[model samples]
Structure formats: C-alpha cells, structure tokens
Target: MEPLEEIDIFIFDTLTDILFDKVPGYKEVVDMGENSFFSDRSTYLFMNEFAVYLGGQIIADRTSSFVESSFD
Candidate 1:
C-alpha cells in the first residue's frame, strides 16, 4: 500500500465523514460550529456542497443567546 501525505488525508477522511455522517472536528472539539467552511474546500463547489449535506449538521443547528432571547 502507498503512503498518504498529511494534508491529503482530507481526501480520504472527508469521504469517510460523509459516509458516516460524522466529522472528527465536531466529535473532538466543543462548540465547534461552522457557518462557512469553504476556506478549505475542494476544487468544485458542488463537491463541497454535497459533502456538507451528507456530512452531518455543522451549521444552522446552533442558536445564539441573543437570537433566542431576542436581545442584541
């Protein structure tokens, strides 16, 4: 078997994340929410979009206190 570079692990890990509907980031870190995580995106936008849909809820599931209390 060939070796995998450190950064290239995303190529494999991202697919696993989609298949399992999990992200290591969310599992290991608390308060880890992403509104726009495209900075580290794939070459095509559709690919990234699809990944997000099946990769579980990393956004829109969290609510801020101001939004909930209606005070800012």
Candidate 2:
C-alpha cells in the first residue's frame, strides 16, 4: 500500500467529519481496527466521491471567474 498524500489525508478527514456528524460515536468505531468503518472499499468510494465533488467545484469556480473577467 502506498503512503497517503496530503490531499488524501484531507479527503479522509473530511469524510470522517461527515461521518461523525451523521453517526454518533463514529470516530470511536473508526479508531477500532476490528470493525473499522474506513475499510478498503469504503475508503476507495469516499476518495472517488470527494475527487468528483472537488473537481466539479473547481470547474464551476473557474467558469464563474472566467465569465466575470470577460464582462469586466
């Protein structure tokens, strides 16, 4: 397994925050290895979802800036 990059850590941390908000005591479960919530498959899915969401946000921001600049 490769080491996590800064972005990977950020995304996982964001997901952890989201999980913690939705599920009480989720952080405790995640810390426990036996029945970890951040399993391989779950991590993969969360990473993919974060990437897509981030990408779209970036594109939208860039587009809005471009349009604003063009009008200025």
Candidate 3:
C-alpha cells in the first residue's frame, strides 16, 4: 500500500479503536450535555465527529463511509 493509503487506514482504524474500545458509551458521551472533558460538549462532539468524518468520509461514496478514496 502507498504511504497515503497506509495513513488513511491508520487514522480510520485508530478512530474506530478509540471509539469502540477505549471510550465507554462514546455515542452517548458525545451527545450528552453534562460531559465536560473539553471546553464544552460541542467542541468534544465536533472533534469526534470530524475525526469520524476524516476516517469515514461517508459523503465521498455511497456504499460505505469507511471506504478509502484512494485508487487501486
């Protein structure tokens, strides 16, 4: 795989790893108002959602969000 492709895989896998493994109830935490790990909930949510966006890139393809945009 190319360096860029490897980077994409690394980012996507890391995001999923942290979201699914490290964080407990990450979806709920992102949505909850009381959660104040950062300056505010919106910041936290935006950061997480943006990471997911970079990792997922759902809008780029219809089949799946995690699909890489790189050409074979």
Model 3 global lDDT (CA atoms, 0 to 1): 0.47
Badly placed stretches (over 4 Å) of model 2 are 1-4, 36-42, 45-72
Query: Could you give the candidate ranking by TM-score, starting with the highest?
Result: 2, 3, 1
lDDT of 3 at 31: 55
1-72 per-residue lDDT for model 1 (tens digits): 245454555674575355224343333222233423344433344346534543444254335432232221
Off by over 4 Å in 3: 22-72
Go through the candidates in order and give the C-alpha RMSD of each one to the true structure. 11.3, 12.2, 14.4
Report the number of backbone clashes for model 1.
0
Q: Candidate 3 at residue 44, lDDT?
A: 44
- Model 3 clash pairs are none
TM-score each candidate: 0.22, 0.38, 0.31
The models' CA-based lDDT, in order, is 0.40, 0.51, 0.47
What TM-score does candidate 3 reach? 0.31
**Total clashes in model 2, counting residue pairs 3 or more apart in sequence or in different chains:** 0
Q: Write the per-residue lDDT of candidate 3 for residues 1-72, one digit (tens) a residue.
A: 799867756665565456545444444544574334333324345456646644444466644423332110
Residue-level lDDT of model 2, residues 20-45, one tens digit each, is: 55543334444655343356535576
Evaluation by lDDT, superior candidate among 1 and 3: 3
